[model samples]
Target: MKTEFTDIAVIGGGPAGLAAALEAKRAGVKRVVVLERDVELGGILRQCIHDGFGIHRFKKRMSGNEYAQAFIDETEKSDIKAYADTTALELTADRKIYACNSRDGMLEIRAGAVIMTTGCRERTASQALIYGERPAGALTAGAVQRYINIDGYLPGKRAVVLGSGDIGLIMARRMTLEGIEVEGVYEVMSSPGGLTRNIVQCLDDYGIPLHLSATVTKIEGRDRVRAVTVAKTDGSRRPIAGTERVVECDLLVLAVGLIPENELLIKAGAEIDPRTKGAVLNDRFETSLSGIFAAGNAAAVFDLVDYVSVSGEIAARGAVEFLRENTSDKNTENASGGADGYVPVIAGENINFVIPQRVRKGAARDLAFFMRVKTSAPRAELRCLCDGAVAEKKVCRYIAPPEMLSMTPCCAAEREIKIDAVNE
Candidate 1:
């Protein structure tokens, strides 16, 4: 029943929470507390020891644990408070957190600003609607990773992966290295669902087969995963009846996708964008609830961890500024991300969705556009039209519904108009 107060309270201690706490402390916020549910600060990166990360920001390759450790060391020198084994159970619109820690039990905390970096959760078998009998052999790719690498147990001897995303691809190769046989990965789309590098290194290099435009139409197995029914599909994603084939396997891993963890944010009266499944925020990263900021996977899924760290820093700065200005008087005042003030309208063309639908008019300031193309486009021109002018265009070689599209904005303030485009 104890209570505490701080200038900033950061939820979750992954890269995002770490970066946010460090940045806020550096910004002259004296009281900052970081709450993480795990015994350690690092989140999903702890079990991931692969070396494909940090190629962009570090300019060199580093393991996931290595990147996480670097951030830990950096935070050690700062005044940010780290609370491991602490879970935030509830968040209030007024930046109040109701949390519980193993050592301290239940506690109430109020902060001038709150930053949510709860991160995302891996999709489970239920999310895919795979009609397989409940079996221990079937598990999420992330779960299998923790069991083998962290918990030290083999998931299975022979496996068939249901998705071709990064996790599934990496596990497909990893299982092979662990003396397990990976039959192949089945992707529902024509193009692979993961990074191109993964498709090459994890599957192509290892000679693991990948079947595109295919899916698990029927799942077979009684007690455990003895086999599965894989089938090819047509353009409409309907399984071609005669193309079904049964493959023998002891395990089936689903690595379909990750969704943002925003339950607490939503319960706290935050306005969530149905598009991103995350909160809709202003330029400052502050949600409709003033003084509450969100970043990292909890806000929206990112392509790289480097961007996750950067977004964390920005959210912390936003939280600190919100406290400094004490803008309760101007709470209703809205800020524009750009100068020209742009509207967002989608053309009824081959475009799935777009992020930050409303682009504020002004100079471009490193805005990241997250989207998904309507269909597979090969050697097509992807253009963004703003107010009847060609604002941006890119030579798109391929686009898939499974893969996310990230485009950077580069325009003057006059680019504040509705976005309409078509694939040529």
Candidate 2:
């Protein structure tokens, strides 16, 4: 194995990784390296051709490819070394990365700080529990997107989407534009899973029907998908006994949800957050393992790419600070709850989850928390409580599970803090 050393090593070269690497370089990290598993730097954005991106970051509506390309171009001009088609096989908690690529055989990279931006993966048919024969036409929403946008071929003439998430909604519109007939989009939840604009542009404007409180129960086909049984569900999401109906379609696209690709984090013995299914991060995006940070979908499945990039920069800044301070995981872990230690950030009523599950008491700057609500409320108030006292509060006209809220509240609690969203 070839051994190398760097100031920082970043895994995954998607938007988050790119942003992290760039920020680290700007922060004066001399030897920064980025490892990408794909043949190119742009990650899933390469397959996303739609134009609803970069509105927050760039003040213009840009396509995914365009947004990613802007960062890619900047990285090319920087001194950072990026290895394409390189796969990181193992990541140790002590800051060792075992990776391999075609050009560089088996390689070992020792980094002072490591950032994970491995992103997230879509839930497929088997994971979604749509039973039947595994057919060729059954694929995830991402697969269909690549097949049409990149490979230039339609999977089928007619399709049935099993989820109402953003990807499913976008694919419905994409397929319609590609001359494919979209039967409908089904969701077990009563409310739409995607943003309201997506529903307006992708489904409603395109004459596509969205079936709420319904899901595909079974698939029927021998070699290719021919039909699926969809049924209405009760409040608990259990299918109603008499609400089953068969919908005929050659393709079934499952966009049920996304899971962060954090197997390496788990293997490295880093603390995991059950709510976000990522890492137990502090305000700096630093994981419990110290020197190791997580960003983007690898941290949590963010609704916007702009937030993903912002997370990368935050993690990079944390990594830079860790390098400058020359701290170890032992020192960091032992300091929790001390005068300058971290405090627990809890999720209260009507709140699904919050990023940066904890925060340092003496943090220099305000921390922006990204969170989703448990249910929809027309008039709601988001609050931050420290030691049972309301420290910060924001009133919202409307709040919903599908819409992720970003708040930068004053949180300098000594022991614990709670985030709550309640109907007004």
Candidate 3:
């Protein structure tokens, strides 16, 4: 196989990968390459034509496609190399990436440091367990977005969206504008999984029927999705027998959840985080493999694309620092291992998953953490206790499973924070 080497290799062409490559180049990494599988550089954003993306990061409201274009346009003003219509089929335990393209057919690329920003995949109807016919009209919400926005085809005349995820809610409003009827949105949880602003603007303002504490139990159809059966749920989320009803529709879009794509990182022998289902990295975002770094969705499921972009830039900075320091002597293990240093894995009452399982107490490294809550927290104080001392503390507006909370170290130390709760 033909092989080449670069300063850095970014695995995705989405916002995260784009931002990472851009930052790497800006940080003076002369040879930066981004391998994207799609013909376009925008990734899924090209199909997400709906407006609402870019609020915090860009400080301006823009559509997903528009934001994607903005990033593409900016890259043109820089020296980032983007390989469109390319795929990395295999990755070795080291940093060797086996990739293929139309022109090259098959090839390999080695880099001094690798950055994983492969993004995520949407959960489908089958995963949702909504008993349904295998029909043409059953599509994931992201697929529906692609059909309408990119393929120039409307999915259906009438629809019923399952799950109150951000994508599902956005589609509810988009369908209305396209003159399609949205029967209802069924969510198993009492509260929505999307941002609070989305629930207000997309559902409440549009008079869209949002059935909380309920879910679509089954779907009925022959060749196309014709109708769906929904049932009310109690606190336990078990369906109430008599609350079932058949709602007619031509399309069923699933927006249940998104799983991070971490195949490459996992293949590189990186420690995986059980909660995030991504690579386990330290404060600087360097994975168990010293030369291999990760950011964006490959690190965790981020709420907004802006956060993904921010994560990519940070990861790029670390990659640049690694090159400048000329530190390439250590193995992927001792250079990055910290799992044994944790005294004990502690989870505060009501706290969700705490990442970093452990931190090295010495060598003076920055400690960062990712966490969420078991349930909705009106107002909970997030505190970390290490060695019977309050190592770090921060107040949270609300903590829920849908949101991933990140905290950087207040002081430079590899101390593990024993997470716990405090009064509002």
Best by lDDT: 2
Regions of model 2 farther than 4 Å from truth: 327-340, 388-391
Which digits, one per residue and each the tens of the lDDT, describe model 1 over residues 1-424?
9799989999999999998998988888889999999999888889887887777678889988988998898888887888899889999988889999878899899998999999998887777767758866988888888888888889899888988888889888888888888999998877788878888999999899999999886567777888888899899777888998999888888888888899999999988877667787544566667789888888777657887887788789878878866845663223443323444435336666655445445555545555666666555666666556776778777766655555565554443433433556
Estimated TM-score for each candidate:
0.86, 0.94, 0.90
Candidates 1 and 3 compared by lDDT, better number? 3
What RMSD does each model have against the real structure? 3.8, 2.5, 2.8
What does candidate 1 score on TM? 0.86
lDDT of each: 0.78, 0.90, 0.79
Q: For candidate 2, write residues 1-424 as lDDT tens digits.
A: 8999999999999999999999999998899999999999988899989998898999999999999999999999999899999999999989999999988899999999999999999998888877888878899999999999999999998999989989999999999999999999999989888888999999999999999999999988999988999999999998999989999999999999999999999999989998899999988898889789999999999978999999999899988988877755555432344325877889887989999898887533567788999989899999988768887899999998877787887656777888999899
* Clash counts for the predictions, in order: 7, 0, 0
Worst 10 residues of 3 by lDDT: 330-339
Q: Kindly indicate the candidate among 2 and 3 with the higher lDDT.
A: 2
Candidate 1 lDDT (Cα, 0 to 1): 0.78
lDDT of 3 by residue, 1-424 (tens): 7888888988888888888889888888999888999997987888878777888788998988988998899877787778899999877767788999998889799988888888888887778877757877888888888878777788899999998988889988888787778888889988887777888888888889888999888889989988888899999988999999999999987889889888877776788878788887655567777667788887888767787787888778878876765556644332434556433436777766665455544554455666666777777788877666776788987776777676665443444457765648
Cα displacement (angstroms), candidate 1, residue 150, comes to 1.3
For model 1, the superposed segments whose C-alpha errors exceed 4 Å read 327-424
- lDDT of model 1, residue 329: 66
Task: Pull out the clashing pairs in model 1.
Answer: 338-361, 339-361, 339-362, 340-361, 340-362, 341-361, 342-416
